[model samples]
Target: MEKKIVISDEQLQFLSKYLNKKFPNLSPQVKIELMDHLICGFEVKGGDDFYQYLSNEENFIKGFINNEVKNVKKTYGKQTWRQFFSFFTSRELLPITILTLFIIFLISKSISNKNAWLIFVVSTHLIMIVSAIFGMINKKPLRKLDEVKYLGAEIWLPFLMVTLADNLGFKNWLIQNEFIFTGYWFFTFIYGVSAYIVLRRQKKIILTKYKALLN
Candidate 1:
């Protein structure tokens, strides 16, 4: 019969410190997963040469972290676009979408000056930039997975919104053109709404994942 190896609290702390020292910027979520992997790998080696094993795997772990972070960002990138388009396909969101477009139409008709409309669109983009800054600063102690997923999605989103807005605002001629300016307002409004929906969904998922962590 084989004896089961259990890691001691001291050993776990040492492992954690080692991880922190090696990867200072590791996301809490990935850190936790890596911890589990280390423990399992150590146990598989008859609980011997833990330090040697860790040292050997340092580069491999770094590569793993890089890949994981990239994959997470890529996934959220796809999800944001998917969520944006979902508004049109979703039966529940259909009414809200129609109402939103009607309101935009009303606003467009009401604003006679092209300059005013350009200002309005640029202001909306500025608001998104502010929101992105908030997301980065608002740190909460969440579960490992929640911290990873929430930060991953939230951090990536603000950059996208800010970049999109900045690029559009840069094209002074686009906003000045009669036909493009009209479509630009609708695009900005819908894009902002989609971003809001995705952020809200992320909050909901994080809250649901670890209700006790926040309390």
Candidate 2:
């Protein structure tokens, strides 16, 4: 039998750091797997020399990272949707809706009736800005993979609100009628909750990956 391919402690540390830099865009969970893949490839394919094996055309780590990326996309996609939808029934969503309704109701009662449209528009900006701020604080390093879901999703509410606001007559209509206001309230409520969920999820992603990168 061939001698065992045991990696030294120093070699393992070096490999871990290399993998972290090589796949900075990958989430830590996947990055950990990539590190293992690289090491295993080096051990199995080496002809007595680790450096030679890594430099050879047959290095398997690249293949491993590609396959792992597919799995990561599928796994993260499902979890992302679940986390997003969970906000619908969450307690935080209720208080926000009630508060929005109360505030908008007050604005409708006291605003220069001509500018009631500003209520939803202003609220939309506030939610999106808050989400962006949270994202800024919980920033993740740039990765090779696509990762704009959190902040990207957060902007849709503001975009929609701006478009709705363009039709000044309809916005006034939404503000003036209790029935129409209910629809507007529901829309803003859903968006606010969704934006909150996305921002929180982004924070979790940054935290999870940051720990992995350190190791």
Candidate 3:
């Protein structure tokens, strides 16, 4: 019986850093999986000459990433977009979207005065900023669901962009303007709903695809 070779921690760190440079876009989850395969599979294959063999054949790493990693990237890309579009089209999201619309309509009716709506907008945004900062400060260990960070960004980017445009005077887009105000609230509420979807969907994905790895 032969003893299996195990990769050293220093070597693992070096591999992690080198591969990170090669595939900087890979999620932390993907990077960890690569390291797992290299340590468990590649290192074992070369046995006594493993280090020397790996040093001479860096292309092996590149080939693995270009093939395996790219495929993973594509699958992730499609899943990401589908989750986003789900906000607009999925039957599950339909009720949430309707609820958000009702909230916006109520906001509009509650503050018929333009100046009142301005105050509401400013106050609401201030609360949102504080909430985001607090959430970031207390965030827990990253799960695959936490990979929903990108999807979360997509949810919020619309509001950020609209606000940026208004502030930059791209239009006389005052929050006091009923159209602009409602549009902002619409995005915000949709974002809230999409966030719920992200949490649920990412949990499913991790359990379905990475259950063994997670366990």
lDDT of 1 by residue, 1-215 (tens): 99977777888999999987876766666889889987887787765666787888888798888888777666656666787788789999878878876765665556665654555556566646644654322435543443344443533343464356557674556444545554666556666656555655665665666566567
Clashes of 1: 0
Q: Give the TM-score of candidate 3.
A: 0.48
- TM-scores of the candidates are 0.66, 0.53, 0.48
Pick out the ten consecutive residues of candidate 3 with the lowest summed lDDT. 135-144
Q: How many steric clashes between backbone atoms does each model show?
A: 0, 1, 0
- Regions of model 2 farther than 4 Å from truth: 20-30, 44-46, 55-116, 138-185, 201-215
RMSD of each: 4.7, 6.0, 7.3
Q: What tens-digit string does per-residue lDDT give for candidate 3 at 1-215? A: 87767777777777788766766655566668767777777656746655575565577666765675456445545655566567779798778777866777677657655654554456446534643543222223333233434433433544564467567974344454656666666765555444444445655664556455445
The number of the candidate with the highest TM-score is 1
Residue 64's lDDT in candidate 1: 83
**Predicted candidate 3: what Cα RMSD to the true structure?**
7.3
Write down the lDDT of every candidate, Cα atoms only.
0.64, 0.60, 0.57
Lowest summed-lDDT stretch of 10 residues in model 2?
142-151
Who is ahead in TM-score, 2 or 3? 2
Off by over 4 Å in 1: 1-10, 24-28, 43-47, 102-113, 126-137, 140-172, 207-215
Candidate 3 residues lying further than 4 Å off, grouped into runs, are 1-49, 56-84, 87-92, 109-152, 155-159, 170-177, 200-215
Quote the positional error of residue 47 for candidate 2 in Å: 3.6
